[model samples]
Target: GGWPDAVTGSKKNALRRAIQYVETIIQTDISSVDNIRKDPVKVRDLMLSLARNTATVATVKTIRDDMVRGDADNALSAPTIYGYLNALERMFVVEDLPAWSPSLRSKTTIRTSPKRHFVDPSIATAVMRLTPGRLLKDFLFFGFLFESLCIRDLRIYADGNDGQVFHYRDANGLEADAVVVLNDGRWGAVEVKLGTKEIEEAAIHLRKLKERINTEKMMEPSFLLILTAGTYAYRREDGVLVVPLACLKD
Candidate 1:
């Protein structure tokens, strides 16, 4: 009913038309900015990769490599690529989930790279030309898209509460899909699971994160959440809330 539904014959045609409209806006902004080069192809390819993968923590080098693979003849220099990415971000075409680094009880090092996502999940699908049937056959990729969608919504809800959304990952490999933080220091951790089978593993990660943080320095989390694409919603005995994505509101 969103991007996937727009990926076919007529729907795709309409989507492309919309993209053309957006491109015009972007180009106009680039001209006004003056310092940034306007490379439509590179920016478009980056959008495709963002859609195809979930919220992959990406560096400038990784993105440049992707651009090279997408079109070697016109591969962009790293600095130029960085400029393009920054421009897109300024235009609200993409956003980053900065890594959360709470004072830890243990000395585990945390990854600092930001997880990259589109402002809306539809942008990725439109850039990638992914249809619903194609997504259904590729459950793994679909799961990533679902996670991106969850983060998009989480950002909205968190903003309403005067908070920001982040992601977490440590050297030991523990991770949380999203972390919501308020200015007063209260925070919540979340994991996005597209299926019931993943709920246990996600809950375990959230629990481990809570255990690792030094509560003396930072307030204990306001709550832990497991957002799902399934039909049911409930609270686990351990106090983690498992709510269907559709049920969430700001």
Candidate 2:
């Protein structure tokens, strides 16, 4: 029963079994729900707070007040909050978007400060103990939340396709919150705003990006999108389109 060298006897079986076990653990443990639920409330709060300003820290007293609505002693410590958030991220429940630099010659450096977003916006509101009534009146807070949601949705969309999501800012301070780059290197610039009122800022930044990197070889996005709270999506004369946040996922 002499076998050829390529048909090694039990060695192949042992290697196959080991690989199966490793695959199971990698796919299951990395994003297990059990791991993320250890301190759901604390994790939620950290993600929500970071969504607004990543570098900002909320003290134990503040977190306690925001989450528990009682004495500061009940609040989670800052270190505890950070730990919970990091764990959730490891479990794929929260995603952090780092600042981007377009090119080396652009003079724009990547900012160390990152923007935090949750896999779901409801988790953020829940952690903040915010209700529908509170969100209705708190326009600024809701706006930020909506922007986060749009960013998340756009990211998902871009991921399924061959595109990248990035934020753009220049040395002169012109900035766009989100830039959608297609496979062919063509790009679409986007700005997220919370209001329906008239503001030309988004259009201004879109034009600045277009002007800075003018190229006829690559096609630009047909329209620059301004994701906002407006009820309907419409195009303005400046070539920027104002689209409601709802349109992003639609």
Model 1 regions lying over 4 Å from their true place: 1-37, 70-73
In candidate 1 the C-alpha lDDT for residue 16 amounts to: 76
lDDT of 1 by residue, 155-246 (tens): 98889889999999988889999999999999999999989998998989889999998998999889999999888889999989999999
Q: Per-residue lDDT for 243 in model 1?
A: 94
Top-scoring candidate (TM-score): 1
Candidate 2 on 1-250: residue-level lDDT in tens?
A: 1123424557554334434432432345433644543444444444455544421223434544565545456577767666665666766666766565554334455444455666656555544445568778877777767777777778878887888777765557777778888777767888888765534877887877777663554565655888887788888888788888777667
Kindly report which residue stretches of model 2 are placed more than 4 angstroms away from their true locations once superposed.
Answer: 1-48, 51-83, 104-112, 214-222
lDDT of 1: 0.80
Task: Return the lDDT, model 2, position 242.
Answer: 88
Per-model TM-score on C-alpha atoms:
0.88, 0.65
